[model samples]
Target chain A: MSAPKPSDLAFVPFVSVENMMRLLHRIGIPDALTGLAAYIEEDFRRWELFDKTPRVAAHSSDGVIELMPTSDGTSYAFKYVNGHPKNTRDGLQTVTAFGLLAEVATGYPLLLSEMTLLTALRTAASSALVAKYLAPDGADTMALIGNGAQSEFQALAMKAVCGITHLRLYDIDPKATEKAMRNLAGHGFTLTACASVQEAVEGAQIITTCTADKQFATILTDNLVGAGVHINAIGGDCPGKTELHRDILSRADVFVEYPPQTRIEGEIQQMPEDFPVTEFWQVVTGTAAGRRNDRQITLFDGVGFATEDFSALRYIRDRLEGTGFYQELDLLADPDDPRDLFGMLQRANDGAA
Target chain B: MSAPKPSDLAFVPFVSVENMMRLLHRIGIPDALTGLAAYIEEDFRRWELFDKTPRVAAHSSDGVIELMPTSDGTSYAFKYVNGHPKNTRDGLQTVTAFGLLAEVATGYPLLLSEMTLLTALRTAASSALVAKYLAPDGADTMALIGNGAQSEFQALAMKAVCGITHLRLYDIDPKATEKAMRNLAGHGFTLTACASVQEAVEGAQIITTCTADKQFATILTDNLVGAGVHINAIGGDCPGKTELHRDILSRADVFVEYPPQTRIEGEIQQMPEDFPVTEFWQVVTGTAAGRRNDRQITLFDGVGFATEDFSALRYIRDRLEGTGFYQELDLLADPDDPRDLFGMLQRANDGAA
Candidate 1:
């Protein structure tokens, strides 16, 4: 009962893309989404305990790679994610991510997992969780603008977490909407493919904009949106990339993930620096108002905070205890003697030689 | 003519610690150290091309976990590392690291390797590389303080790159020095285990301090370090953890990795904010003086820069093409139709079901 063996420390559990997909299906995507939303909600409730900062971003000519790190006192997590709009044209996913969760006491990685699928899941889960507190009561229908890689996840997470049963989707390209329609086929929802944003939002109480253009172009103009509708804005996530007109933001009471980050990357970037906004966690903690009235437009401008990723990782880690969806990776070098790193190398040479 | 398949895109080559040791043995440790030094030298020569930022650190009651990220436009690399002083007491490594290298344009990781061994290799490479420029000519003996995990690597790198042939080691714990002596037994050099710091420094032209402590420390005093000698100060990396006294810094012209990071985390942290320091790259680029005279005391105040990690990763990546020491892990999610991430997951679920 003295100490754990050093070789036992070499293994860090890793969930690959294939394993992540199996885990998602095994738990059922709907149940997974709801479970993930619970974790997100729990973390949001104790948001003050987190170390929050704007993600460190490295911008390039065609894309950006970002490292989002956060920690509670007990655990630390960071996500390595990249966004390249042109990647689709080259037959690659626009986003591919991986993340690690570590023990804060030892700074050792406990889990390393492919985050591309998990990120899409968590980003949608975050929206659904926020919608629970901000969306108008009895909001059963959602209008999904921009049907792309994340559209189906967005639709299902909202259905499972926010009780939105009907899905109306629209995109500038008919093929994107057709693809999304096919993916969500027979998923227990009444799905509609609309021609324009106006047609998509016609009978919807919640509108979600997730366009992917890295520009200031507006997917939703002021005239197109009516009052009493909750907007879950997920597409405008980087500087100079926005989906809604400034006029809509002026009229709406905006809620964000983290202010310093969302101010630069969210739709509210078009607003004045001193513009008033409420952090969504404050609403979760019951300190801030959410959906003051049915007629009041509530906007959740989410850039996807690090804590949501941390929550998703924490959830996956807890779920991996008995599940066979993870592989123990030889990620860290643990010498038999703590100070004998070179001796470990020497032994490896002897074994290999 | 067609796009790469999704499975192919998901496979990222990973070199585990055992493979890293195999590669080092294949390349020979001295040559590996020299090869890594060349890459480090190359990167230091064009230091401005890199996007240099201080590491994002998360401090806890126990230790710190840091993400050091840097990009040179064509490629991006980041190292995840942690330092916990009490880890050794629990039979865990005090420092453990892993890193990834990616294509800057696509943001796809090309290689993921265990950097605990690589960092140890690269830190020694950096010291020896700097010693090539700053250490006295024909210097053959080095006094190694704190002969712990990094001691033997430092001694060998100095032998390979700086032409040092003799080593004098000292440690408060004789067991650490004994461990180093055993690890470096077959390596070709004259080894001397000294009793004290004064005994260790006698007739040595180079001095290396690589201790592991969490508080303010003076491993090297002012009068103990004389003129015409080069000092590679590594252990004094974190805030409040400095190896040399302020008087030693006052007498020596310190060259640091990155000024912003060094001013906060290096030995220079003990000096005033306005204290004069030179970036080591200027000397590499021949824009600044390295060893001005035989009487000058030069210090390479290296707090392990991100570029050195980048270079080590770059080197390991290039060396992995034909080496059978790498495993391709399914680390990314790539959908055939880039817009249909749900379709990919659905197919995976169907296959698994």
Candidate 2:
């Protein structure tokens, strides 16, 4: 007799890029962003329960590949991500990613998904979630200083999570601003394409710097930032890649997610080893102060933590439950007899005959 | 009026479990085992160039999940594997795995393959490769202890790589030995099903111990082991898990894959922190001796290493070139302009329409 087919336990649910987009569009980008933010906030409220570790990175001559892993008591998650700044010249993305979630009890994978789009979503949602606890009162406008791949996501997430309806967009390449403006056209935001960073931050209460240079290039100087503004610094995520000037970081009361990671990868890398900063999770849990006065500068030095990716993976797995948007991938080998794995392979040969 | 399809660069070649078995069968198990051994030997010869790190592990109460990553400057690879001994009670394999290969220059993944079968092949190949260097001259009979999933592969690899043609198998459960003997009926071998470990090792020059237990249990006592024998210790691969008696270790000249890892995971974990052991690569490179005389026992403390998986991955990627044994997975997001990721998401809506 031919070998029996692999059991259902052998298959893992996989969400390809196309399916991820369909799921996002089905949920609507704004609603998905808000939903992701809710998960991030919930995870943050119980942040002490997570097994937090800095991402494991292997740096090559041109770029780096990293594995960011974290786990709650019940589930474990990891994202495989790479960043190569020079890829853009070859018509390739500077960043790409995929991720997996597994059951802690059995150590069996539950879901696998393309994390490129999901990463962009989670990063934006993380920023918006933190803004809810840190931004100034009546913050209705945001100055988006880097109009690149992440620009439009940041814009929409802000509008969905924090009710910001106006965006001032700026980029070194004017085409980038045009691209962001075009992408965000009908998203119910009043978009202004600005010529310079100074013009973008003119009357905005939230200034987000997200340029994509590998070196320390100042996208926001001290003069461009004002008091009572929440600075969402995104581009300065790797060591030696800060975007804001030292003067701005010096003046702002910085908030960070996972201090050990932010100390190495965020804009706070320029600060002293012991330069005091409040953990954002504490603020979410109402233990730490945020935006104490109208003149207080609350800067969220966001470097994108593993817990955020864990929250994102959990959110997608929950949302895709009955959607029929994923394919079952035969990624595991399940043999009837646990001690007979070779028997399984031998049977496969007979089946082939 | 519609968005263009994702470019070929966005697609990654994926080999599922079915295709992996197909590829192995197409190559033939004997030849594939020998081929994998050659690759492992070749990589070990140039071992100094590799970036090696002990696997990053997440240990829960039931089992452990690990990420083993390594690079040879040109390419990078990692395997995600889990070992939950209790999974067998729930009709799941105790171990399952998948792996990926990526370009170090571009940080883009090239191949994703199910590594459960490949891991088995590589482990057996690694054992036989070491046996070639350390097994006694004119050795032909192998005492295969613990007739589990890896038993047949080990038997075949020794035949292919070391010209062994006889097997003496024993397990605590007689049914396991019956299964192994039945599976090896067609393969050319003089199979002897032994009731006790002492009976299995009689007149045998090579002894392979591969039991599946999560705690320390002696499979081979010192009195049962004779002179001029090579011990392929396979299953004592984690902390708190060991198979051989301490007396046997004291009498053998131990060799290991990577000391930092083997010290914690291999049978040598029973030894002291500063215990002297030879690096196996040194033996392969002629810097250290393998077998000295007819009376010395040589033990290969084979805690699986990342480089072996790297070799297996490289072998699969090379052999699958013209086989059409893989499917292209849309795992990456590629936009016309690298900065237009949001635009790509927005245009997917247009394409859907």
Candidate 3:
């Protein structure tokens, strides 16, 4: 009848990279990491409720782009992540991502946000949370191998969530370890710059392997890892991209986010299909053993999962109310009558023209 | 290394709904439709060059949400769309979509645009482009049944691409037909609002059945369709959502986009799995017959596919340069050294603080 005014439902909140940074700073990084850990832990406690599917991926010669989607019946979330190691040579991030949360009932997007930062945070939180269950009791020092983008977050998340306060960092490139040392400077960890991966693992109760190479090279050998150490393997995440030796995988008690996915993307992909591994959620739910003995090696084959992204999305959505950390995007066309889309466009032309 | 300065790659161009509408008005709807049809035709000509996947779907009790992804080697695109027919009763669109294009090499997003408008245009363009090949020669009038949201776009696309100058429209609801007629006014098409589907199909060489229901109700029976007519069957784009009677499909020469996807989502889903149908690209390539003789019943069972969205995205990317119809968004977190992600976030904190 008259010109259609846009309904409130037409707007979806978007958190840009700037807003994501501000949100992290506003909440403080340690607090954000702690908050994310809680969310991740809560989701893991009810893991069976999630609709988990292996990420849909498109692989190329240089990289892989993946879409990870999961729903908790009422809410749905998906993250678009691309890993291009060569991108850094062109001054781009090795990994960049964005994600959205939507109401499953209406299929309307509730929030769209930059996920590059969030993914880093969630990966760290997940590693530390798994370490909380799998790492030896009184675990304090963590040897963070491959001191790249994820190193400091892993160090700080371990401190915030798992009561780990000491760190030993190493990378094939010395500059990466230097970068991580500089970033984790203000954080409350006794940081160490190690000469080699062997030196980094010395006297460390936890070993975090997060190398950026897209190859199957061994960052950790079986002999280097002692009987009682917990391994948080983060970088060996894609097919043909693994960091630990198959010998290391054979001796350690491997735990994974989701078995079907980890078998394809985790370090344990080197193992046969029927090789034994425990679901990390099962350990969280007390249905499976985590750290079985003082001398037993616990390995969290930490390939990132969709449910963690879902949790991060839920956390961000919950924190968005009156935060001024988001902008409303007019992403959907809202006509006066749903069936009169053309009429709506015509009126806009008439009004604008 | 110095703190990371934001790179040009950090930003992605975003076209909002208002901007998309303005872009449509800037390049008149007919020209845009014609342009889209050209892009679709060009892509169809080299259809084998694109990497296609059947859309990934999440079905609910009432509707389904789908992700349709495709790549043309150099670039990639995916559309996020939802079909909730009952949404109209709440004054919401049954289908709302947005899509993104990315560099295949780096997996960096090149463009993020509202595809609600674009999908409408592309779907119509696809139907009309197919009609150009399949419709009987000298087809001047199209019977546009189900005068709803997509009706006007289909009518105009036919006029712009298929040389159809007259539209005979009908709907179950009188108000819908009135809305479509009102929107089509001032356009060049001679529009008639018919009281019934049979009346609308009378004397028309092309019939487009596009109704929005979640069931197998027949909008076109075997007796209603005459020989030598082309049928552009849209709207029956999900499981159990056929608009034509089974007997009509038995007699018509059904052509579809990507048989693997069409066999599950198109009107052909109503037929036996072994029922024969031609791939539409074969007809475009002249490997198969379109409208071989005047008495042949050619049906284009249009279940929206991913490559068409890729074509629309490519068209939008080509048009975005120098148009100033988009805004750059900091959707990606770019670091100076791609591996120093933590350093980038730490600097963001330092600068902002």
Candidate achieving the largest DockQ: 1
Question: How many backbone clashes are present in model 3?
Answer: 0
Off by over 4 Å in 1: A1-6, B1-7
Can you give the lDDT of residue A88 in candidate 1?
Answer: 86
Least accurate stretch of 10 residues (summed lDDT) in model 3 chain B?
Answer: B1-10
Name the weakest run of 10 consecutive residues (lDDT summed) in model 3 chain A. A1-10
| Number of the candidate with higher lDDT, 1 or 2 | 1
Off by over 4 Å in 2: A1-6, B1-6
- lDDT string for model 1 (A79-155, tens) is 99999998888888889999999989999898999999999999999999989998999999999999999999999
Q: Candidate 1 lDDT, tens digit per residue, B1-353?
A: 01345457679989998889999999999999999999999999999999999999999888999999999999999999999988999889989999999988888998999999999999999999999999988899999999888999999999999889889999999999998888888788889999999999999999999999989988899889988989999993788788899998999989989999999899999888999988889999999989988889999999999999999999998887778899889999988888999999998877876
Q: Which candidate comes out best when scored by lDDT?
A: 1
Candidate 3 per-residue C-alpha lDDT over A1-353 given as tens digits, one digit per residue, 9 for 90 to 100: 01223387688889999899888898888889999999999999999989888999988898988889888888888899999888877888888999998777777788899999999999999998899888999999999998878888899899998999889999989988888888888777898999998999999999999988888888999889998999999993899989999998888899999999999998988999999999988988999878879899989898899999999999988877778999888899988888888887788888996
Top TM-score hit: 1
**Model-by-model DockQ, in order:** 0.85, 0.70, 0.72
Instruction: Order the numbered candidates by lDDT, best leading.
Output: 1, 2, 3
Chain B, per-candidate TM-score: 0.97, 0.97, 0.97
Q: Judge candidate 1 against the unseen true structure and give its global Cα lDDT, from 0 to 1.
A: 0.91
